[model samples]
Target: MHRTVFNHGIKLLKPTQRCIPVAVLPTRQSLLLYISNHSLQNRNVSIKTELSGTNVAQPKDANNVAHKQEAPWDIDFTNIVEAYKSKSNYEIFRAAMVFQLCTIGFLVEHGMTISKYMKKVTGKWLFKKSMNMSFYGHFVAGENQDEIRGVVDKLSAHGVGAILDYAVEEDLSEEKAEKLEMDSCKSNVTPEYETMDRYQPHREFSDRRKKVVSARTYFYEGEAKCDDNMNIFLKCIDAVGATTDGGFAAVKLTALGRPQFLLQFSEVLSKGQKLFERFCGKEGNLVDRKFDQLRFETKAAKLGILMSRDESQKWFTWMDRDDSGYVDLLDWNEMIAKHRKFSDLFVVLNPETGDEESLLPKFTDEEEAQMKRMLIRVDALAQRALEKNVRLMIDAEQTYFQPAISRIVMEMMRKFNRKKTVIMNTYQCYLKSAEDNLCTDLALSQREGFHFGLKLVRGAYMEHERERAKQLSYDDPIQPSYEDTNRNYNKLLKIMLEHIKQGGKADVMFASHNEDSVKYALSTIHDLELTPQMQHQVYFGQLLGMCDHITFPLGQAGHRVFKYVPFGPVDEVLPYLHRRAQENRSVLSGSSLERSMLWRELRRRLFKGQIFYKPT
Candidate 1:
């Protein structure tokens, strides 16, 4: 009754057995192997290897057994979720938490009183402590490595690993943060979470997790004392283990607000608030010349402001270093995004829908000066990231701050991305201009001979951006509708992959919680016949706890998957946490599959009478 298994780990199938895929199985697939006509005594067996991520079949060379790539769905998530299900009421607690998140997200997204109410209530200690154990604990890794390690191990068991999201802030330390945030109004940056002490993990525990996990890093710029803040976050990693973990690291340009006075700057800059006007020396002098020209042409149309490029591609071309035959949309949009950021470009737009647009005159001398200073700091961050052999990602801020962020990221990429893509730029596809902007970036990469590392997300500031546009009576900068945004996301992904396929160098991270987007990415790679090496250039990302169903299976199938693993004190990371809640309401609602999937998983586990763990 013994069945024969080949030396290459291919199992011999019974003559009457039909092949079934692991994806369709609610449980682990028991290797549906079928043997072909080959001499058994000759010790060579031929088996067709056409399995997909789930159960679908694809054609491949039958003999190349040593180098097989499993489809993303080959990993069974029932056991994965069940293991985490063993962790303290993980399922039911999260279900309730997600409901709360959806409610909050709906209110915030819709511009209701709940957003304001939530913010006010977050200031209370009881509310703060309660959320830390529930929502925060679910999403963020521990404030320290011990807690982080536990969560990391749990995630790895399911094939999804972690990326630490560390935000720098206005205060120098936890002591200052406590006084500045908790004691006063709401903490501009809140909570003392990361235990920054030079602590070591137990050798025993270290050895155990070494097999299970690696970590990616996120640099969230705060302000002031950037060098110090950078040192703090960078040092937190157990460098030796991280190198072995096989994930990327990051550097955030906008988060490091004031290098010298970084926190002071970031404190004011949070939520897109502007600091006081500053003197801008030479840049200001040049802007004034443009201003005079603009005023002469437009007859004081902008009401005390002037813009030379109101009707010109001349300025656009001047910024297009690659001469891609089109303006550097990144720079062009940044100008528009920044103007909107500073004083609402929507305000200056004619409600008459005249189709003429205006931009803010250049920055004040001091503001321009700050950018120079910030670049200096950004260079240091990029250099350090290079030395650490880690990838740096510049977070995409609001349009107001994005130009500076984009400028910093481009410089970092040019300087460091010469050999490999150590620096990545995040592109928000929700904006109509993003695809053209990315194309400009692609041209920059080609011209400069650098691999463009890009992170694509649907976008975060839809509500704020739209509300302001409506308030200011300008056409919104976002895509006209959600369908448009999704279309842009899928199209940009296709464009990015095609760039890599055509031998244009690129690295991309598709960060989304949407199931269709995830499937589309995998299917595109499969259809394009992107080799395994090329596929590595593409990675899938989800916020930890938001899309485990997608990330876990993808990770298990040996696909590169990353989870945004946030680590910070309760109060400090609260704003980010709140935003995640809102994002899910929008992202997870389309098909109602998010809820159905969770309920199915929960009921299955409950029926199994699995061991239950309590939520913290």
Candidate 2:
């Protein structure tokens, strides 16, 4: 009966319209006759074929073509039954129900907010209960430090790790603000003050006041309050350390100081040679023997000139003593030394610590003492973070301040990274130079023989960075297109993976919402023939409440994964939440691919009649 059915099916098939032999059927006489007849018919059809070459003959075997077309979606019922035989049907059903519920809950909560925010910039109404539930359930493990442990344990059971961020909002205060300023000076002695002063309405007074204020006051009483908060931050790290094996923490550069200040300091250091030439009337070479000797012999004389109440008076006095083309070397040296000392003093003082009197024409000796005290406090904070084994992931801020923070954190990493990845640097993929910067950093890590920890982020400060560049008539640092940034990110990831695979000293965490990048990393690992355990070298990170498709599956498959859970007081976290909502809305609406996946998941659940909710 089966043979008869097969024969009937084959008989229903047709030859091409051009009479090309579609199949070589066996004749009653012999197979050789069938081949000869088929070949001759095909040859004739080829010769008579249209010369335009637009249409090509398609397969004429209806049964074969149907099977070929259906192969992709065809299911083996026997294999499906065997796959489920090992497990109870109820258990399978329950698991499926849970998965659907979680997915639906996630979409409804975040999707609405994303939709609303995408439509309106000032859309406050989107912050509804569903949104909070989605963010809290999917993104946040717990509200405070204590609540994270249960979540951590559950995730660990599923082979996922967590990254804890103590998301504190900036609080402006006279005392705390001043301490932050002073501590910044001690950690980084760049001429940031001068650059920042240039843009301010009261540049001269601000500059003068910063010079006069004591470094200790800047550290202890002013902006240093933010640094002091580090003590509490370290405690949270300790908690995570005790709870989970692969947990990490994060910090921000702005938490330390303003970007303008650091940029100013970098500019001054960069232009040191030019400034030195201007200070010396002639293009005197300090490297020359005569210049060196002159500088050495008249050090006190230079100080005396600088100390003189009037520079004009001192010049006239020098002219009276000796008639020469220029002021005597002795007077010039004295003036230069005094000027140098004053500049040095200005660089050391904390701008934020000054009282009304300190901001006066000149800073008193007492204010200088205050600046020194602030430095000690900052050092203490660094010491605490190191002692606790708390890995500090320093977030990238504006380009201006990033260098200053990098220097400080790199120093800390050198000191503390010996034990573990204590300091992690973040690269903003949107920046054109970020990839180059990362490569340079990797080279430095190789040369220094220290473990390099890096966090790759798409970037957070795009609008601000671009606007500032436009206003200043400078080239924008961001990538020209999204594809460019993704390409760079993947390249960096490959570099990181290579470093890890070789057991070279580097740790990488990919923080992205783009599913393609995540899939690429996974595929790369598989192509490299590395097992899941060995592939733990690469960590997949996503912001809380975004891209569960990548995160959950990789996590379930035993790959190390992390959610960037940010927590702080409600008011402090509002800005961060707002940004999160904006990003979700932008990502969801921007791509039809994402929208389709979301709809697919939604349909799958609805079709199964398993969309009913249960209490968490």
Candidate 3:
């Protein structure tokens, strides 16, 4: 007897028609029913291409390929007892308590205010101990590399990998940070003074505040901090490589340089991209468009990117190497790169009138130097990752910083990702232009023959993006609705999957907590018969201590999954904890479901008299 499979739906057909059901696998909810209705014997898989409408059938040995591996269908996401087995009863109880607290509207909504109050009243010793015992212990891996190693081992034992993330992302600018050592040394409030007394207004304090001296400026302090951050990143890369081969380390560009500079750089890139769009006179693909020097210079000047006649002629001759009177996409990319390092085509000149003034903010010499320093740090990190056989994932930031962030990551991809998938960029699908950005980058990678790697996220900075857009009188970058965001995410996932199907050199980490999207991806992976090295090519990631139900089951089912393990001092990672709390609130139902599962598992363990208690 034979069954035929189709890409749409499963159906029972005459034995003579085909050897297996010729249809797409049903979703997670319906897959069990479909599997039960038909026997596993003689079941063949045929995947249909969406665009070409052609069937690509799997080999008869497809079912037997990973016969020793546990089938994904055997592991149920709701099997809380099994999922929480690695977690002790006490840990489960603590997680449940945390989730229960997150369910409270006021606590989650007013988290930052409450955190401030807690910081004031709790006292350093008592507060730090309490946090470490509860939320901090639950969310963060540990305070240092040694601690993170233990967490990594524990997770690895459960078949889950770790993506090490150093949690020091404070963006205090060098220009804004005061040199406290000089004047602070002269204050009446000594280092021995208690917290309350330190705030007291003494004569010395008043005198220090009254002094207005640029003579003791510390403009280079921020650069030093950037260097410090870079060292920490290097340490993190080492930790990741040492703990887990083929592991991941997350990088935030804001940590390497001043955040204000990133915002200004983003503004410049956005304006330049817009200028290119207008010059090309079309939206889709501007890579092959013929270039006109006069028109390009005129348009760039209007956008406040001035070019001298000599510079214009120089750029034209260099870009139009073929003498075809046209500079394509690669030429445009080179121009952007030159603008970053040398400001070749973009000359900052003083304008006599408002209309003729540069629309972009000019960077100080120090800021420009810091930009180079930041890029050097990024390259160093990439080199370390490549040497250690680890992948570097550049995290997505606020929309104002994304243009610059994306451009920088693309350059890194060009440098390091040509041979292996060492550098991965992140894309936040909640943005309105998520697909467009992904398509543009993917096209560039394809044209340039680099291994394109990315982490697809639903987005973290939507609230901030929208609020800033509204405050600044600009169009909102976020999608209009949550459903739209999901749609965008799934669309991007499908695009990547299709590229993989076509044998393109690409890797994607579906870093999401949405179960439906997870199921959708799993179903498609099976349907397409994409049996790549599961660990390196396709990945599923959830934050530490957030989604064990999804994480454990995916791991148990023989899929590559990792926990986004954040590590830093307790006080320094408060912002990360706050964001985690807010995200839990936003996905209240998911958290509630996990909590319910935890409770059920707790009940099971209690009734079974298998409870073991330990305090770490």
Candidate 4:
């Protein structure tokens, strides 16, 4: 029940019991004129909201309600982005159907994995945001903010004043973080980049296509139990000679770091591959002494001792002093021969005393230099990247060396990625703790004010990692399932986007060919309101000769896209090519978009002419 009052030629509807404003009654104009002194307290507000209509409700003519109002908000996403504006009919049709087929397959796979009720929601997600929404956004808005406020007052004057702002601004805009910067500007002798023996992107003077050339870095073989030390050494030499940035060079400590003192280094080299092969070959003990002599000479050479074949006997006599069935006694003897005490050595020098302080090595300048040279090489490599503006990606390696690699990469990031991204660390998303590590790094970047760049990949050394973990009786470092890895990978992208939004300098080279991941990242960028500069921070990447479906669409959309072109001598890059081939097999199996695209393009070519039809 309501009452109407006419005071000084003005009409107002008041609810009985309490003086509810007639303008909020939601009824058509029954009351009249201006709503005078009705405060919002004890307002007749309900959680139920209506989102339809055309005109803004106004103060009614002696009625409790105003005229019908239009919908609260609208956004024009039809023009927000154009991912396939320039694509041909065949290309467009093929691209569209590929997503559709993929959506169906994804729905079937992911649907079966979720709860029955969630299947419906997830299925809808696949159909919409996962596919349709990614393709286009319809134009939708009418009244602006000022019009909205005016209409709301009109509604209050009549009856209903319950309209919510449809275009909700996220609290994410205009984030102000403490501006972080590089501490010391070291004047590096910038290496002459143009003359470097690397593939140069055809300098696209026009805007038709932005081209990029990237260098491939291979894993290092510094670890004691590494399989390919010779290759690792060769890679290090190449990396040291690199001149500029476009692609990253990969390195591994397992391939590079040799802590022989801790016995952490692989015995493959120390034990002598020749000796192992000969012993396994059982080539008769006719040359057993010769084999022993060769092993001693080789080991002495590796240890950098000036020795000859004649000195093998003397070396063996010195090394076999204790005959403890180990060669480290020679090292201990060498330490003693050089000095009365040892300090600051990486190895535990004092076994008799558990108190480490009692066994500290007396630091000699020469010994310290020798000890640091190994780690200095790592710094030198990263510093070289920094100096030449060549991006360095410290490849994720086996868990044994991953900890040290991660630490060193973080240090490298601190020093190199201070402004631009010279050192982009790799994250193996298949690792269960990758998200945690990403968060930690992102937070560190935010606090320190340095931009962080990341090259994300699914774990490469899973077999090796698991094999070592099992052998060592430890839990595996890999995520439980592919789905888990996928989830983490996508989640990491969103977090990185948020980090970028929150005033952290960040860039990502989205290096996966997974359609779902690529779509999700694009959606994230769009939602975050990509500026031209933000586009630079976000990059889509794939290996050369792969995933053109993802790469081309993203590139066509005016976003930066990079194709990794491995350049090296046949012997040097075969391992890299083979590695990508193995990885691509997995990607192709899960999402056969690339293969499908290739077949379609081939068919299109065949149909267009008797001879090969050129691409439009």
Candidate 5:
């Protein structure tokens, strides 16, 4: 006796013609007893049970393999909690009600104008929302440097340190705009034309010759005027130094002068041979017989002939009695010398140096004295900040201007990073060469004997940089793939970690949002068998209101962490906020998987009663 089930409208039947013993039992227990008896009587007979009415046959091998392949039923949350536990305790203090009140007060005192400006640009409602989201959420630590001491104290209690970056990106003025234009014009002028005589002794006058003086003179005048702005910029550095911690103040290269100067210089150099040829042709054609004969035969030579022979030439000398005077080599040499002198002057004048007399807006002697007094006040404020143990982190800009900024910050780091990391430089890993650049900077720190502090970012200026490169027909500097950039950033982190472990000169601060990157770093720390304190050699940073899962837990766990707090007049900060919003929207639109995960997380939190509903 045997029991069978059929499914999917298929029937199972016993072989009709075969000589096989079969028992039919009306009751379920009797049928089972019969099947057991048949199985016992004949070893060849097999007994089986199946789901009712199912035609599907389950093979023992298949069932066993499937069972073996099933994933584990439980997840390990211990490591996640441990990672979070490793963060500084001070972050918990920041979440307290008292700290929140202090943060509001600080905003009122320092960010009132910024708030007003935001209201004007984004409307009152949006401005209020943004204040809650952007400023209150991310850019601020506490009410003031002193008020933030609670946060610092908390971090310090856990052996973590803080770096301070004062929000002082001021709006560009009309005067500054005009000065930039003039600087741009000067930068376009080439050293070759400025140094070499435009009057070539080898050619006849043409349209090309007519343009030389105006071109060269324009370049010279523009460069000279531009130097004044450079002087002003130098003064700005002094001004920053006077006000902020001398070893912590960061200056942008763009703030000093126009970037177009270098571009213009490059353009001129690119077209150098053609311009030289044109000038040479105009100057060299003096030996043409018609011009020479005409000049010798008549006391008054045709102005056209003379002009054609020496178009724009200030001086010329006769080579033979029969020939028209050739443009003097000595004159050419003098022009070159003068041009070199101008270049030398521009290079030698330190734009960072300025005195009251040089900083203009025509002041009376008393006013000058008062302004100097104000600068002294600025210095006092900076010193106060330093006494509070504030650290400064400088942001990285475009590659072209980065060298200058790097040099400036390195100098500051040498001065301030001695006792603690008071000065930090940024590394943008999205650039193709960023990893290599980081290595180079690390080497520099080692050679110079300075404790290096670095903030690693994925880079913010990718699209703009790429488009500009395309328009300019230059090779794009950004990495083509996100993975490539991410890989490089991680590689850099590994290198930094190795250096730190070896007791070499380096301090690392990671500013990232990618989960993989954060997890990779955590895993690396565990694999290296580094202690929590040794692991504190690195700090994780995230923007406020973003990745709270990582930040909140990490901070709670006892790791060193900080948020970038950008503060300014609302109008001044609008551009930065707008960029952030735009980027977020773009990310959401482009990455469906990420968007889905975020939505799911949000829903789960809402369902679990972990998040309260709030209207934006």
Candidate 6:
């Protein structure tokens, strides 16, 4: 029966599960044949059910189960000449050279250190020029909007959209923050930002841990620098809107405020959420099942909150939205999300005093003002994106910072995503709690009556996250192995795709460089029978100067695709460049498919006696 289905280019399934046609594209036949002829005949497939909308075939026989369901279609990445035909010979040559260097494990791993040493030996002037002609030229779009316009237009010409990123990030370590604090005290210098008139002076009620850890080193100077980043993002939004309809503007939340504040903020939420979870026992919806103000207060106070009846009543009254004297998950989420509204609700215990207090009350007047300023900047950027019809995608950072990032981005979505999915959050699938994160956010969006927007990526901060966990004596946040990450990525992909198939108000960008993941996404989309117009909400993305084989074919095949066009001054974007090189080293070094394809294309060009041939 499976063989018959394969012979015909029509859909056939077990009537219980909606399987896509077994037909393989001409380019994918070899791969399809290898899997089908060797694996599928023996196993009986069963669809696994879960709370989240994830459904995949599970074989009854445990052995070799993973091998039975390779996607039946693939994008032909081997057509290297066709993919490179759109690029100039010089561009291709430079990319080939850059990727060739990326193939060297030692160089990629130590690229930043080596570049710094080279700069010292070569002098800054010569170093800048050389970098501009090589790595910088290949990876980044340009330094400013006027320069970036050409890159956008070129990508648009090839049916690919552009995601403009102003590659400036701000992160300060604890040691650096302490140093700055000492330096400022020695100089007797006032902070760069002035205090707002409405806020009170630094108070004693804020959680003690925050005051001790983040008070002096919270990037007070960055108050002004954050404003600069906001302006750059505004310009990026304009550039995307002007150049292409429905383009994307990539914004990093860490770039907008102090990293320590975010870390502290995340810590507060993390603890609060765990307490909430415990308060909602077995079924997870205790607040909704029965409505009692005293019960709620008793539960909270027993769980370490020192709220009096009157104090807890303010929360109960506010959270009981329908005025029925009952709070549901949605109602609780609504109140918790407005962190500024209920200061007592967003609290952490004072480590020294062992008493609960809000993070806000402890803030110095300047710190409170700084928090407002950061929100204002984020609001302005989101407003500009909405006005410009640009999708604003917030990039995911480290786990310590991610909870706060997700929290704020969701707040933006509740506001701007009412009519359209203008604000999008990122999900890093490599995390241990990836599915839970996705399910929670998806549920919130549904309950709040807003569009859910997301971008999925296998995380980039693997080494940093692992090392930090080891040093801090905590459980590692990253998945144990590469295969685990891939499985999580695909599972999350299925959940979102199924949501779209069911006509849920959601949008997702399947941003990845992994070919198998990409093929699986495409296959799932086809199975769901989404038309090209419906696919406007779906997207694929790869970085500029990397994975042209995937990006170009995706564009040429008429799917909605985008290149992450990072732009900044050469010196400013070094960190981003280094990460780009280092993170992709596995794909570029030893037995890398991309390098082999580049080599194949280079060989073809050489044999044709057009090694340096410039495309007309």
Task: Using TM-score as the measure, name the better of candidate 1 and candidate 5.
Answer: 1
CA lDDT, candidate 5, residue 387: 55
lDDT score, candidate 5: 0.39
- Per-residue lDDT of model 5, residues 263-381, tens digit only: 32223222332222333344432222122323322312211112223321222232222223532222222222122221211111122442111100112233224223322322332
* Model 2, runs deviating above 4 Å: 1-154, 166-221, 258-261, 268-382, 527-534, 568-572, 587-599, 611-616
| Per-residue accuracy of model 4 over 375-404 as CA lDDT, tens digit each | 555565555545544455455644443443
TM-score of each: 0.60, 0.55, 0.71, 0.45, 0.47, 0.71
Two-way TM-score contest, 2 vs 6, winner = 6
What is the model-wide C-alpha lDDT for candidate 3? 0.60
Clashes of each: 28, 35, 15, 34, 32, 1
Those runs of model 6 whose alpha carbons end farther than 4 Å from true positions after fitting are: 1-73, 88-90, 109-133, 142-151, 168-220, 282-329, 339-367, 568-572, 587-591, 609-616
Deviation from native of the Cα of residue 313 in model 5, angstroms:
44
lDDT of 2 by residue, 507-548 (tens): 677877676777777766656655433454456676544444
Q: How many residue pairs in model 4 have overlapping backbones?
A: 34
What residue runs in model 1 are displaced by over 4 Å at the alpha carbon? 1-133, 167-228, 233-246, 258-365, 584-592, 611-616
RMSD of 1: 21.2
Q: Which has the higher lDDT value, candidate number 3 or candidate number 4? A: 3
Alpha-carbon lDDT, every model: 0.48, 0.43, 0.60, 0.40, 0.39, 0.59
RMSD of each: 21.2, 28.8, 18.5, 30.6, 33.1, 17.8
| Per-residue lDDT of candidate 1, residues 39-81 (tens digit) | 1112222211122111111111211221245354334434446
Q: State how far residue 52 of model 4 sits from its true place (Å).
A: 68
Residue range 320-438, candidate 3, lDDT tens digits: 64566766555555554444322223323333331212323334455455566667767777788788766777777667668878878887888788787877788999999888789
